[model samples]
Target: MAPVSALSRLPTGAKLFITLSIALLLLALIAIGATLQTGRLADSEVRARLRIAANESARNIAIELSGDINALRVAVAALRGDPADAPSCARAQGVFAQQATIGTRFSIVDRSGRLLCGVPLDTRIPDDRDDPVDVRILNHRGLIVTVAAPGGAPIARVVFPTAFLARLVGSGSRAMPLGTALIDEDHSLELTSIPGQGPLERTETVQTDLGLGGLQLRTSIRSAPITSPFLVALLLPLLMWAAAAGLSWFIVDRLLIRPLRLLRASVAAYTPGEVIDPGKLGPLPAQEIRELGDTFRAISRTVALHEAGLADAVVRQTKLTREVHHRVKNNLQVISSLINFHARGAPSADATAAYASIQRRVDALAVVHRNHFAEMEENRGLNLRSVIGELASNIRATAPEGAGSLHIALDVDPFLVNQDVAVAVAFLVTETIELAMTCDPAAQIRVAVKPGDEEKRAKLRVVSRAFVESETLTHLLSTRYGRVMEGLSRQLRTPLHHDPMTGAYEIAFPVMGRD
Candidate 1:
């Protein structure tokens, strides 16, 4: 046989606990995974917003520079139409002044790098004018644009201060602080100061080219802080998972487990012929459990009622049977009295002997009836020992004058049998003893009842010297007595064995109380 496992031996409550715990653990893991995924998405969104800000800033700066370059082209056209003199420079400066905005200035410079008009800038002009317009950044301080004439000679130049680029980048919002800078990669200079304050906890940076002489726009944002409320949000599902597990377990234990346990205990304590009370279980939580208890209680009540009915029927039957036996016994006694009265007035000895024989057979039946009635109350069958003993005595007492010294020895074992069996045994024993007495008046009869070869069966033996085959005994058995004993033996459902050698008549009888 296989050994029982520890987990299998555990009660329902313990198993439920383990199952709920595993469910909680799985839920916790899923909740944690969701929280982490949410964080990643949030980070991606922050980086996307930063990239958008950088691209926007770069676009705005390019638009501003394009407008200034267009104005520089006008100044260059004015300078190209006249000689390289003070008057022409004056007119070009006048054209430049009309297009200039705050923190911006322009100058017309010759091919030799001579300042002809307007504000002078400490910057070199590229001699190679293959490009019509040239844009430059100077130490992150200002943006310089130079436009060449038709002969590929420098004509005009414009300088916009770094402060002008700062206004274009704009300021950061209170929720998500941003830092913006215009960086000149070639010169390694930051044209605009970053806008924001304090050390950035989580920062995302995006750089976009401004398309003006290696100038690039850098945008950085400080992500929102991870507050207590945010952390609470992340753990909310886990908290809910735990709460749900606890609530579910409580519901199961209260509604299912606990009620079932109580019901089982009540059933275990129930006795036969008793009803199980549903009231002992108190109030149940779920409807199903309540219905189960009600069903069991109803079945118990039904069984108890059935047992009560059967008991009443058995009692009534016993009383009726005993009354019948009592009446039969009275009738037999009356018959015996009538026979005795007739025997006293008999004209011959044989006539009186025939009356005695008839009286003895009637007495045997009466003895069987009396024993059967006595055993009816106990429901156990009649005891052959008592029935046969009383029967033998009655026979000896009512013996004829010829058999006045009749000696009958009883060696019967105590065994029970039904009424039919008792009646047959009584009649057979009476017949055998009388036959032996009639054949030989001084015959010694020994009646023995012993256990048979089979279970719940007994062998009844009547041993006597008179039972041996003889002319006198044969003459007596040739009468109705032989057929009467054969009928009694057939009623017992076994053949009567006559042992000529031992002079014993034996027959097997069924015993009672096999159950």
Candidate 2:
């Protein structure tokens, strides 16, 4: 393999290297992005899974709790129906328990929030938060425990900080309605390994001195699915580029470069356009090389037959070169036109803006094509600095005097990009320059594309050294409206972010071309 810095200097090698590098970089970036996204998704999925587990566990516990409480209720009702026990000042006590093998402890609270009943010795809890309850315990901890009471006012609070209870319950505490914790409610924390978060909302109650009573029921779930499709979207092209580069390099180097070098060097002794002798050269190693040598020899004989054919040859080559370039330009224009058509048809402002950004990138390639003359073998790896500077100049030329003075400074190497990506970045620079200038009449824009941490990573930065105040910028950066910034992000395949203090809007997009 060649050093990266050296690859850009070779004729066809540079373009190939650049194309591969970009593809690899994009693949790396996408892989990284996908990995990151997947990691996040997996974490979220784990959380959701845990939450579901917790909820299911809690729901089962709730059912068991209801059964235990109901059994106690039946006992109380049976005793009460006896009339003598019904009016007794006994304040009936019953234990809450479950039949599942998973460990569980039960506790009961009276109408006045007093602890009444059978329970494990370990737990120490308030029978009721509303009126004041008491509890008598022996062993406190067990698996799959539950606490419930018939009287609604007296809430049940279960505290499981013990090692045994902690092991039994994966994570998360179960709370009953009208529960009290010496503190405020209405708080949210994103923790892994906890679920239920079911249809529960927070409602506060003013209890006479029993601290603050609040019921925090499971509300709507805030969990998101773990797939980041955008990261995948950015990766597909990178793989194609990699496969293309690998195959092209093998073919071009063996078939075109090396053999041609041997032919030109060996045939140098003969006159320019002379009738070459095939046997004069050694037997070619490969069939293709031998065939090319023979073809060159035949060409020499033909050239010798008609010396005047050289003029016609030059004319034909020139015509073909011009035709090829023209067709490429027209092809680029068609792509740009298509992008524009889609952009105009976009239904929302954000969608339109995204399409507009896409069109701009296409336009940039179109500009490059416009500047390239016929006969230029490859426009890949075109100087980014020159293109950027020109793009900035173009924005200034089209805008007002104050905006037109905007200067662009580029600090990036002449990395390779295909006509497609190059055009897009060009438009990005143009759009950034124009927008930045418009934002602040005296703004100076600095656009830089630099290699990032890994080979598949690149950073395209457009920053303005200007002062403009707009609340819309904050809205643009908001998570609620992040999708609205389609233009900047679509071009970069990254994200658009704005820092309030510096008033800098940075859009980092992934480009399929690399170092």
Best model per lDDT:
1
How does each model score on TM-score? 0.56, 0.30
Give the per-residue lDDT digits (tens) of candidate 2, residues 1-515: 46765765677755766777776776667666776676566556545544554455445434443454445455444433343343221333323222212334343444553544434244443333433222222232222223333344223333222332233323434432122111124332211222433433322222122111231123222343323464455555666667777777877766666666768886776676577766665555578777877887888788776766876787799889899888988898788778678866888866765665556556666677765452145534455555666665545444554454656676775555555555556665665554565456677777777775556455667777552346644343353334444564675566665565565555543443533
Please write out the lDDT profile of model 1 over residues 184-240, one tens digit for every residue.
Answer: 646544544434444534567788887765667778876654656667877787787
Report residue 27 deviation for candidate 2 (angstroms).
70
- What is the TM-score of candidate 2? 0.30
State each model's CA lDDT, in order. 0.80, 0.51
Stretches > 4 Å off in candidate 1: 1-30, 39-239, 260-280, 283-319, 513-515
For model 2, the run of ten residues with the poorest summed lDDT: 207-216
